[model samples]
Target: MTVTASIDIASSPEAVRAKFLDFASLPKYHKGFFASLTPLGPVEPENKIRVVFSSGQKMYAPIEHNTPTSFAWTGSIPLLFTGGTKFTQEEVFSGALSFLMGENAVARKFGFPEKTKKGWEGYNNDLKAWCEAK
Candidate 1:
């Protein structure tokens, strides 16, 4: 299943980039999903980071990119699914920001695609509010 969500923020891409890269603050803005984010090492492309969900599930994904306008990570839940997710920031008219989130996943025979899509919607809405506040 693939899902995507996006929103426009009132901030510049540079400001959004800085906030996006601050892995430690993820839980603060993304209240429900992330319980904590811990860096495994230095922040760089391909470095691993641990994401502990509020549900207590842990996932480790490698940084696919750390550029000013884009970032991504690829990870999997063993025996269930595997996927990659990315965030992109683009400058729009009047200095507004467009933030997009996309995910592509290949799931096993048992998977809940509908539920995932709904969750993405909520996440994106929350992200929009967070970025716009900055």
Candidate 2:
């Protein structure tokens, strides 16, 4: 399942990229994001970073796509999550949340209905607030 959101931001792609690179600033606006972001090292597209959640869930992911206008990262599997985040600067700022539960896991683990969808919705709303804020 995937949940995505987009909004227009009156800023250049470079400006948006700058903001995206600043993961530590995420929680200040993205309510659903980590309570705090700790940069372990340089911010490269393939660099891995640890995300410690307020709820004490620690997840890690390497930057999957990083460009002058966009960036994306997929959560590290069994230890982290299934999907990650994406941003695009084509008139509107866009964000996406996707979960790829393997067939075995889906059938055995998270068989809970509506749980995943709700989580994604919350994530989308938070991203919207963060990106659309003036």
Total clashing pairs in model 2 = 0
Lowest-lDDT window of 10 residues in candidate 1? Answer: 76-85
TM-score per candidate, chains pooled: 0.63, 0.53
Write one digit per residue (lDDT tens) for candidate 1, span 1-134: 23444445566665556665576777667877556667788866779878786668888878665554555565522111112223322212121211122232433222434444454455556655676783
Off by over 4 Å in 1: 76-111
Worst 10 residues of 2 by lDDT: 76-85
Clashes of each: 0, 0
Tell me the lDDT of candidate 1.
0.52
Residue-level lDDT of model 2, residues 41-108, one tens digit each, is 77666676786655677867686655554455565311111122343221111245122332346533
The candidate scoring highest on lDDT is: 1
